[model samples]
Target: MKKSLRTRLYACLWCLGMFVFLMPEHTNAQGAAPSEHLVFSFPADAVLKMHKVKIVQSAYTEYFEMNSFTSGYAGLQQTPDSSKGSSHTLISSLWDPNTSAGIYSSVAYQASNTYTGRFGGEGDGYQSINPYNWVMNTWYNQVIRAWKSNGQLYVATFMNNLSTNQWFHTVTLAMPAPSNFLGSGNDAFLENWDSNVKWNGAFVRKAFFKDCWNLNTSGVWQKHTSRYFSANAGDSARNGIYDRAFDAGYDSTEDAYYMVHGGSTTPGAGFGTGRTLTLPAQTNQGTAPVITAGVISSVTASYASGITTVNWTNDNTTSPQLSAKVEILDAGGTVLYTQQDTLPQKRSTTFMATLSAGSYTARVTVRDIFNNLSAAVTGSFTVSGRGTDTTFYKFKNAYSNLYLGVKDSSTANSATISQYAGSNSYNLQWYASTQSNGSIVLINRRSGKALDLPGSAQTAGTHPIQYTVTNGTNQQWNLVVATGSTFLIQSNMSNHYVLDDSASSTLQGTGIILYAASGTSGSANQQWYQESVSSGLSSLSGAAVSAALMPAPPVTASVLQVFPNPAVNVVNITCKKMNAKMWIWFYDVPGRVVKRVAVTGSPMQVDISSLLPGTYFVKYGNETVTFVKE
Candidate 1:
């Protein structure tokens, strides 16, 4: 905050204390105050750090989604504050360079200088500029939230010198000290002094404290203190002088960040015994820099046909787990689907997949070795989609799951769900088969189930060759296979999806969907674990051979009951075909409906659990029902 240059004798000497002062040390609810840590620093070595972003809204997010797409606007451009337009904005896969990090009225704040007339913001940070900002970046436009906690993530950033143009609000949190702040010995000293200072003439009054210093691996800012003339004539500037070799290197291999705003721009600035004045010192602000602590263990999910499989595990010791990744958020915290799994090394795990059914949350994040990260270990899932009973359960949530598409059946809303980021039309192999009481199934082809959903599972007519529901998943169906471990391609969750209806894969006819896994070694999709393989037998995806019993059956007519059957925000579907074309599904419990909708009609007597509740299994074709939406 050195920002000198008022020139006209400091512009009438300070226009309204530089347009209102700002003091932000925000916190939203919950308990345990202050502990943000990172206090004091000077030459010893100078390195400071911090980064966090906790706002994960999963359970199928949607609050004003214009068809969301953000890694911060994905370069469609605009944002210089929008002259008056576009902004579905939720961007930041880290990388902004200069403009649009927040406040956007359309750019204003002009720039009377003093570093854009005092931070151009709530205390300044330049307003907008980007050469992509610095290029070669893999991740550094500053979007750090670093994850982990239970598997390891113990970061302690140190890079502070606030006090120059004044805005040291308060970063007071302490716990480790002994020459680490700026001097660079690395015992990890972080205490929190008036927010480690980042000022602007002390909040516009123009200089009771100017502020400037950078040592989290330097890009520039040094200066410390300065006294320029009379408090009416006391002439005090604090003396200034504590500049280590700078950015205190512990080695910075592409953190993607680097800056040193104005030694006035640099030119000879005295190594100073008395001389000193290379000028520079103007710097902006950087918060929550990066800090995480750890301790979780275990969480899993998977699905076939509708695709979805998740994993997690971490043990913790200052960012110990080392490698772990899994994400699928949609309630609004964004990030829908991200997988990089590996297990067997020392156990600790995390992996996710195809994902459909509904209720999905497998955050699990880990990273160690100084890059620090660990503070995420969530688990929730619904996935279901095996093969038959008509097929149409395609549910996509968990932070928009990148926009998968197709949810139009009678419009219960989710805006008809169609989003994509990692797309190839999705679903390579999705699944969710559970029956230990939990329940879940949602098939897929497009949308609209034929019956199955708390409305009750019972069907007839289409029972010509297969269909039969005394309730063995009404007649299961689901598929896709690949296995190994460290995540080569998981999705056999005990495997079962064999459809043929005589379209045969051979052995025993073949019209399968089963439910209860752990069966293998057979191949042709585990041939139903053969051995005569009876039990509501159908086998060949059938068209004829077996399926008969449908004379008086068909009586459930179900529509929706999706309750706290394991839910998260609101999922209660009941159907009678409101407007027209319908199929409100969410299956698993053998049946299969990984989450479908195809909506078109309307009057089924509405009530769609805000998109997600839990424990589901609602079909439309051969009928199926099971509820719980709480």
Candidate 2:
């Protein structure tokens, strides 16, 4: 088998030509650790089935080694051509600070740099400037299109920084190879190379690959969900460097595209072979139904005895026949009634149930033909037989347990109203009567005065008062039945707010005010329970009471005449309407109460001159009269 010298020389030249054609401008340096690669592979005949390939890899890293750089690529490859050498093209997006600068686009013959062995030197590789500073720790999308045209192989590469939504066109390359002559298969791979011949130690890097697709020559895209293999440097079938890094399917709602591999650098471990990963089996499901609109609108409930009739409306006019499932829940969220029914959808539909007196909420849900459920709609109501059926009653704040009371049982033009803990006070009783205009007027039995808003201020926090009945809009109120036993006392003057104690205070004498009404009935300040009492205030008269609810005229100011002015020890307070609980607060010039004495009855005696006093103000009930004592 010996050959002539000329033949041997020719053979050597042919081998050199093949090496140049198949070789990458890549060379491993001493002390540099081998780069690990995560490769997503397809069928061995993937080159024939695929016309284009794409991958999106989001890097969760920023730092790169000083002397070496790492890159991830999406490309088409087939088995190496042993006779004419390897023929494969790869598009690489590199994060090299020195060569590529930032995330830049480049084309490669294999994994590193483009080469032309048959034609002789390095091939045109890098193209397009890295437009963005290429944000660190972000994902970038890369694509490769490959197809045979008129007896020639061509590849066009494109890249986009997904984080920035910017794209750049890389160089397109051509070769005279056919699809059958392509190397291995389409793959996504990461490579680390030492450009300076020294191991500066590579930093750990990781990326996520998702939303991969394959386009056939007919221009149809199909999902590329396939199994892949993993390997280390020692495997004989290795195509790239291998490390301890790995990849698996993202397998979640946010990202369903089985992710590719990522890893930390393993110095001294050279690049090994590429491996394919395997995917779990799954069955396909059809498209889901469209979303439906929830329809329940207003809810009105009325209770008499123990029976409560609940009525609600659905406003979906476009679909009047829409069906919905309804559930009535008690105050504790326990389901009391559940029904699946077709909604009238226009007028109000009624649902009646007999239950103990308490608050309850209605839950409505609609479903489309495909069983897709809509968002839930809800409303609240109450059922109570205690005092709502009566015409006259006392109202108690559910949160403070305080009764609404008129100041000093006043029948004045304007008298303060407050919440107090006095349960036996007749001044707390009110007559509820519907006026001719359909508004309710609450007349205090003790004062014969109506509940009013001073100055007719409809603003929140305005303290309510007792005023002479004029049937003005400011004196009208509405009783809105809420959760069982409790109701919302809403003023017709301020339709947006309800009667409430300021700051939900439980302290006695806290002024009863108004607050913005909320959708939920859980707030204590808005809930009031009624206590059945006398039915009419016609039997009560302001003159029959000793205390003039109205301010005493100055001519009759002698009604509370104080005797023994400049008294040495005892001062007598003569008032016809005095009671034991009624007291006089003696205040000094500084307005501080210096002494508080109980008035057991008319002509009560108070001991003074116990301390210094120049001028004093005596407060009896709501009236503050001035006197001096030595």
Candidate 3:
């Protein structure tokens, strides 16, 4: 085969592809060379089952180069080596409006045997750590059938190496495990996969890739339960977790985890803000979403120092598996850490972990109590130095059912690439990475002053503040992100924590409070400030007041609230704490919601812009929450 033909084969392979590379040279006992036939599983999972996904826009994150240096893309539909040891280490992550963040996956390379060294050319050329054993022979193909395995689905890749006039079949990774997982006494809110059935599916709904696996996997890739994928999406990417959040619930779907990410240039105005930079759940091309895990249920490792904690959150209603097993993997792929303790049915959990110092990857293999195992959800990170590790989560102040937060100052404000937030759905915010004097750090929504910890210094869990603009009377504040749906605002101030009211986490109408150490001990005196607004700066809060006014602050103008105070649907604002000048406006979470009345000053009744009933939050002096529709 000619060298040019090989390069073309690699390039065109993104779409349809075919191959005729030399047989690999793996040595056998007799010292004879191993034929490609012996090294690869022909007509195996490697055939491209779908069409090549193209560069919609220039994908900025071009770190690895398998596909020649083009713009917006790389290859995904290509098949993996069916043979046991054949694999490729594919590194990918988001390269958009935000900076590039990298992630890696090991794949089976069908081209050669025991490939070593590294390969670098245009774009981010694929390379080997050792530097001379592996070689990625590029090929030529334009239209190829891209396939996704998810392992079980047995996705296949078929490329028509237009240059060589040959067709090749390759298999991708395995199907993702079911939504649930298994655990032992360690895990707080996951499944116990050890004794459950394993659930795996291709979840391949992208139309570009046809059902080529039908002829291969036999019966592994089942149509995603619903119409292809009628199932709602499950959020995966999240950052910033803590150990003692029992006082408050942790939600990755809320503003905290999703919006706290960096910016992206994904084309259009939509910077892949709050969500991970990977492709959407059901997009047409390139590498598809993947989660892999071996059957091994439990593994353990230790955290040298700092804080050791874990957070688990995923809506498994649609993809229900049973339990989940979390294992920590060492550099050699050995199970160094395992947390398969008692598991919770639903919701996310963040608890303690043994501290250690080293590079570690977490592998979560979920299963149903019945013994069904879901594919593995794997993530990796390294631990170095240590300091105060306080994380904040954003919660739905209006509905009160949702909880979420984003990475904050403690994380070095490195402006690391976080995931994008959902539409109109509240997510966390904050994008300032610099600390220079006029830096764009988070500022108080009311005071206009830059927000910082109380003592003129800063701590990990410090609540931002600035008592000037509006909530000044109640020390109100709000969290903001450059992109995403709704944002959370610390609109009210609490006089008590409500603990003295009933010593219970319930009985919420009392009032919102500050993050003061002394007050938060379940005391009503440690109340918070909150609110819901119709639009603009038009907001209100009916939160925290002096404990002396507990049980119910006299119906004084000082303690009344009509939340989702600022009405979106039929003006649904329930009054509890009491009130002040309830200047209301109806604005979209994007600071775009309209108001029924003017909201410039806090004089009186404002308009809701008569906009259709949607999600809106009401803000009292310090409390802010969501409102509903008719």
Candidate 4:
């Protein structure tokens, strides 16, 4: 009985021993080769570090680690799952400082569609994983930035896909108190993390690392000029397994350091473990990006939509801008609304705010990848209260003295607008209806179509047209107060441009277009005087002309006619039968007198050679006529 019990015990003990021996081979299987690393040396501690990686050869169950700092690591990995074809992912992880004391790294911000949680096995820590199907042989730029904020250390990771020219903010991790900012021990590695024995010696993993830069604590950038090649000795020591299929060295042809492991990769001479490789002297150590101050040219507030559109132009087109921030401030300089857009390539942006009628300013600033900020630029605009006048009126151009009318009085959509002699025609009349947001819509009496900017074209020569009323922004207008009773008919499309008679032509049937606004008091062609029409007139034929629409006699006190209004060098004023010498003042759009002369002749020739090419107003006695100097 004793011999039988001993035999059974020995048999059980042998099976248990076999199970223990096979566990390492089955569960703890290492890749076919040892993991290779390129340890970089930095001159000082860095607050920000950037690295580039190009996967030359990739396989399943391989991790091409990019930025590995002292506290965390970030990289791209290919999972062992072949069912989904190529399962790629981007991982950023930070080890906990002390798990027992409950001090650990936590997620500060996690991008959408990304996973962030606690991870274990190697060490307890926080990790973020984005399921990114990265393509092979493509270069990707990665960045890790650290800063101390709110008494805690924060680290953020970013990646740029060079193929698509798209940037992605992977994750931001915040470490609790007693945690250090980004320190030393920076390196990159090619790891085969899969323990599947079938993948051992079956797949190759290779990549190139270059353009490694670190922004040191002193706000200076330092480039990596040398690298030390090594492998993970811990894996071999713990698993009792070792494979020599690994190689890493500086590739002069690519100007980058190449690392490879697994699948028959033989270590080259002078690249043995713990060997340091010196790279060629680099002439182009990249400098920090500079973002020139953005220019905010126009800011228009739309009362109808409660939207304030800000337009700007960036001078830094070569540098990749990360974002543009816009702030709307009230008259007191208090910020009322703020908006940020990641697409800094766009020339314009809008902010929606329910603001009262008042003046406001729009401020814009741009930021680059290095967190460099551009100087702020600002523009001012006014939001007028809603118009209470419901009267239908004629829009007479201040420069041409011709009425705004539809071409040929056509009721078709997209019928171009033109200037014509005043008449009782419905096409020449528009009813301004105040919108909920204080903007006005000009509905023509003839076709019920709204005055439109036609697809909201930003070009200066784009003619205004009539379209069915959809109350779009192109159909909205803002009557900005100009000199005297005239108003600059500003388009809601850009708010920077106003209605203008083409070439400031006084001839009837000339087209009207949009041009950039001159200033608060715009050019004569861009300004208009609204004449209220009597409600009794219904038809055009045999209709009595309103006294206000009648043209002044050639010699009347209310008429100062100028020949060759858009003259090159001189203008002839025709005021026949003048007796007394009168002082004639030529004023620019802002009501500033540019030229003054005392003349008594019936026809006075005024030399306008010194005047710039723009609209000018000539006032003689009580009469004023606007002319354009070409």
TM-score of each: 0.24, 0.26, 0.19, 0.49
TM-score of 1: 0.24
lDDT of 2 by residue, 1-630 (tens): 122222222222232232222223334322222323233333332222222122233221111111101111233222122232332222222211122222112222221123322111222123211212333345554445444433434344444455544444333333334444223334433332222222212333333444444443433344444535343344211222323443444444424323233334332222233333454422231122122344455665554542334455644321122346667788999776565633222122233223456788877666522223666777787766442333357788878888899876667867888888846566888866444333567878777789998888888788888988766788878665443235678888745478887888999888888777777453777777766665321122211224433224322222354433334466666554565545466654322245766567755778886945334567665445555454
lDDT of 3 at 261: 11
Off by over 4 Å in 2: 1-133, 147-150, 177-184, 195-202, 235-277, 281-630
Candidates, ranked, TM-score: 4, 2, 1, 3
lDDT of 1 by residue, 367-392 (tens): 54233566677766654553232222
Off by over 4 Å in 1: 1-293, 296-477, 480-498, 503-567, 570-591, 594-630
TM-score of 4: 0.49
lDDT of 4 at 470: 69
Best by TM-score: 4
Q: lDDT tens digits, residues 195-243, model 4? A: 4565554577789888888888777877665557776554553222436
Report how far residue 37 has shifted in candidate 1, in Å: 24
Better of 2 and 3 by TM-score: 2
**Residue pairs in clash, model 4:** 303-437
What C-alpha lDDT values do all the predictions have?
Answer: 0.26, 0.46, 0.26, 0.66
Write candidate 3's Cα lDDT for 410-490 as tens digits. 233222111222222222322111111111233222122333333332222333333222213222233331111233332
Worst 10 residues of 4 by lDDT: 13-22
How many residue-pair clashes does candidate 4 contain? Answer: 1
Taking every candidate in turn, the Cα RMSD to the unseen true structure, in Å, is 21.9, 30.6, 27.0, 26.5
Stretches of candidate 4 off by over 4 Å are 1-31, 81-86, 177-180, 237-242, 271-326, 330-356, 375-630
Model 3 / residue 300 / CA error / Å: 4.5
